[model samples]
Target: MSVTSTLGNALSGLTAASKAASVVSSNIANATTEGYGVRQVQTTSVSLNGQGSGVQVVSVSRNVNEGVLADRRAADAAYAQAATLASFYGSVEGAIGLPGDEGSLSSEFSQFEAALVEAGSRPDSDARLANVVRAAESLAGTLNDLSADIQSERLEAEKEIARQVDNLNTSLAQIQDLNGDIRLQIAAGNDPLGLMDQRQVLIDQIATIVPVSVVDRDFGQVALITESGGVLLDGTAAEISFRDVGLITPDMTVASGGLYQVEINGSPVDSTSPNNPLKGGSLDALFEIRDELAVSAQGDVDAVARDLIERFQNSAIDPTLSAGEPGLFTDAGALVDPANEVGLAGRIELNARVDPAKGGEVWRVRTGLGATSPGDPGAGGIILALSDALSEPKVVASGSFSSIPRTAAALASDLLSTIGAARQASENEVSYTAAKWETLRSLELEGGVDTDAELQKLLMIETAYAANARVIQTVDEMLDLLLRI
Candidate 1:
């Protein structure tokens, strides 16, 4: 080969080695960077008249463990879902309080029962009668507070859904923009590895919100589809939409249009069903809290309210309370409309005739709710009957509990037990999902860019560079000898 061709070959090798060195240096620098892909410089041999002339630096390619990455993303979604549910259950269980705890639902019921017995023993004591009224009010007020807490959770979930939808849209749009930018870089023969890394970050963000699957497309672009076959992006990003219902109530529901639904390209997607498009993520968990979990909680508490209302409203228990008339407890100060039992827990209140704060007499506790006057202040008949009604075992009229007879306090205990069971189950799931996520995450990191490996690659690149430089130096010396001759 001519000395000039030899020089040209050395120059090509120098260029290839320099590019390889740059790639290795970048890998080392970004070793701990999240979502940064390890890169390698690609090369091909140049040909002249079917003979190798030199080396050509082709493209820089990224080394990504696609399988591990996919598994990690799925684990991310599962962990998000489990964590959200566990948090919600923990909140509810905390609000209800443990058995025998002060201010707990069971404690309030027990206090009311105990107060009733005290007043029945001293029926003439106005203070004891007032204590009985106050205890009853406390029990009703506790139910109201619990119902309100559940609705608050529903409202929070509603707002969160809206926020998540907006974020999902923003992320999808950003991904689409990155996709286009990556394609442009590829077309211009520029390295798109950096843009691809950024795209992966955005996709990981989206994965926690909703599970997605990536699909390879031409021109270095990618498409995303939900696990349940909902197209999130093809060539263009799908517009995810949700309407913000600023206020929510127990009566409000998505089915009745009181709550909004999540939409994809203007098509409704059920957030609660097993076939939900965006399942196994935080967004789905929020929907479950709003539409299913909170609603169920409200149902259980309202059942307790219904039992309390009916227990005292019986003519046999309180003969003075006329048919369809409220007893010791009233629904918003009136008789309960069975059709409107959805929010009864929040609306339940101590009957006005016995609530001194409402211009009623405290002696009404020993008399009757419908009694016109304090006929006999020392009459303990009515007070003892009221106490019996509270303590007697009776079948509940509503909720998922068995129809077997239970005292009012026992029903209260059952509510706590039910919510506690759910909370424990959810906590268990959180533990399981968190472990799975961590294991997958550790596996992915184990396969990630290794600084030591990158340094070794750097050493190889340096050797190749030195060899190329030596060849050029030899060629320069040979050319000088030729020129001198």
Candidate 2:
């Protein structure tokens, strides 16, 4: 090869080597960075007169597995959702007073059962009857508190969903802007590597909120699409909007698009319904908590309440005490003669209690009386049923209103078991998913990072640079010899 070509090749080698080193340094620096992926330098050989001159950097690329990234994101959503639901269930556990001694739903119901035995001994004794009533009241209060707690979690989940959607929109917009910048840089023949990395980071983040896919285009531009076929970015971002109506109460709607939206330039795009790839994220989890679990709890509450009211009133003394039998006392014992036996019906109330400060307590029974005077037999039975319902093993069917306490207790046990099982499943999932993530990370390293390879490249570049320096030295020596001769 000609000396000039050799010199040129050596110079190219030095430049390429410098660029590669810079990329390597960047990778090492960001190795521990969250959401940062390793980077690679692409090199091509230059030929002079059909002989290899030296290598030149073609481009800088990211070391990423797009499919793995998508999978991780989906997993992230599921983890978030499970975590969210678990947290709410924890609240429910506290509100329902699980794994405790006193005032717990199970314990309270047991106390009510004990009180009933005491009441049966001397049904005529006012003190024993009052004790029974108070126990029933406590049970009702617990139920009320539990129901409230579950409802509160549902509402909070709704709010969180709204917030996440808004944040997603912001992230997506930033990605579009970055894409534009990258395209411009690439078109100008500049290395858009840094910008690409930043955009990739953003995409990874977006995946944690929803599922996503990327389509590469010329000029370093990439299109962002949701798994649901919604275009998040095409030249510019696409617009996405969420329904304002809530999963629970239609009237109790949260703000729209607060969690996430895709905007393409200025136009909006609708994400695919069930086909939407955006599944794993905190937003998805919150939706599950708000819709499925909370709704189930609400239905249970309604069922228990409706059944209790319907059963006792039919057979128990009516809310209105007659001329012979006096109506039950209110807060005080002063009683007016019942206008009719139906007075007992109004006296019954579902009494439950819960910790207002905590998140998860719901479905405790409280005062059975709606508007009737207190201490009537029917009202008393309603109160007793509320107390014992948590421990009983079977559902209190509509036909057997008096058997509510036993039914409720059985149902409560079943509910608790269901939650326990769900929590266990979540724990197993987290472990398995974490292991899978590690496996993917290992696969990435196969072609991702190798110190030995980098060192080999370094040595090759150094040899070329040294050979060129030697040529210059030889040229100087020959000129000296010519002068001396």
Candidate 3:
């Protein structure tokens, strides 16, 4: 090669190496930055007629995997949903109390059992019967209040999810717009690094709601897509919109799928199945809360109530008289059906506390049944039979007050077991969700920087830069000598 040509080649090499060093420095500077990817300056040989000329920087490329990145985004959305749902359920578990605690349902039922036994000792006494009635009402009230509170919390979560969805859609649209600007600039061969950085930050934010995949297009353009292969952004932008939707009815049930559907440019999309990769965000969490935890919890409450009502009514004591001789007591009434009441969800009230002070009256408990007194003599057989019924296995399911004399304690034990089972199910859900969250977090960090590795690359770049500087210095000295000759 001629001297001039050789100098030109050296200059080009120096420029290319300088650009490489700058890229390495940029990587090292952002080593700890979240969502920052390593940048590389691609170079190509400038050749003519099979003759080497010099090197030229082709383009700047970011280190990222479109498929893996999309997966991470989807995982992020699911993790957020699970995390939110778990947190809310955990709160419910706290309110209900843990296993073996006095604050638990089991402990409360034990208190109810004790009151029943006390009343059985003086079945003829109005005061004792009143106490029994009151205790039953209190227990029912507690269950009603707790169930109502759970439903309230679920409503709040639903609203929060709807708000978040709107915010997420706004962000997605913004990203699409940025994509358009980036493509336009790159098509004209302009450096859009700043815009690209902003877009990457937005993608990271999107990942927090749902996972996404980024496809590098020509120049500095990027196409954003969902893990499900839905085109979130191509050359143009699209709008995502959300609406406040209902999921559960007053009867405590999941509404139809249409209740929580999402829309894009007026077309509906399913957001239930995670595998189908619905829009990633807190919406997923709300859906699970409404459909899974809330529904199951309601079922558990109904089961407990049903068991109590059935058992108590079956074993309840009913006094009989000879030719209607004023009855054994004025309040010798049968249990009321709980299911007829708004709160019991079709359960029956077996033992309601009667207030004897307000005249011999039947107490109202669990929507129907209350304490009763037979004003006449010879009501012993009826009371005894009732007591025997309570002694059977189904009092927790039956609501029978008759077996209070012998089986009170056993019934209380069963109540405890049922409550424990419900709480355990809630805890299990929380545990599983935590594990899923950790896995997603690890995936997020996979494409993120390793500071140690980046620092090593920085060192190598620094050494090359120094060597290139020395070469330039030597070349300058040689040029000076030749001039002198």
**Over the stretch 130-153, how does candidate 2's per-residue lDDT look in tens digits?**
676567567656665666676677
Cα lDDT tens digits, model 1, 1-485, are: 87878888889999999888888889888989989888978899998877668899888888888898988899899889988988898889887898778898989999999999999999999999999999999999999999999999999888888988999999999999999999998899887899999999999999999999999999989999889988899999999999888788899998888988898889988887788888879999999999999999999999999999888887887788788788899899888777889999999999999887789998888888888898888899989999999988999888888988999999999999999999899889889988988898888887778888888888888898999899999998988998999
CA lDDT scores, all candidates in order: 0.90, 0.57, 0.58
* TM-score, model 3 to reference: 0.72
* Model 3 alpha-carbon drift over 4 Å, by segment: 1-3, 47-53, 81-85, 88-92, 122-134, 193-201, 204-240, 245-249, 252-261, 267-282, 306-316, 319-391, 395-456, 478-485
RMSDs, each prediction?
Answer: 1.7, 8.1, 6.4
Candidate 3: tens digits of C-alpha lDDT, residues 1-485: 66556666777877887787788778778767766666878989998668888788998887765565565566566657656765666656654554467555555566566665665555566565566566655556556555665676667767876776676677777777777778788778876665767777787776666566777776566676777767766766556665655544436433543345556667666655655454555666676675566655655554555555544443234322222222211212333334532234223333323343444353222112222434443233444444444455543333322333324335444433444555566457556655766675576676666667767866776776676567667778888999999
| Candidate 3 Cα deviation (angstroms), residue 287 | 1.6
Considering lDDT, which of the candidate structures 1 and 2 is the better prediction for this target?
1
Separate clash counts for every candidate: 0, 83, 42
Q: In model 2, state the lDDT of residue 270.
A: 30
lDDT of 2: 0.57
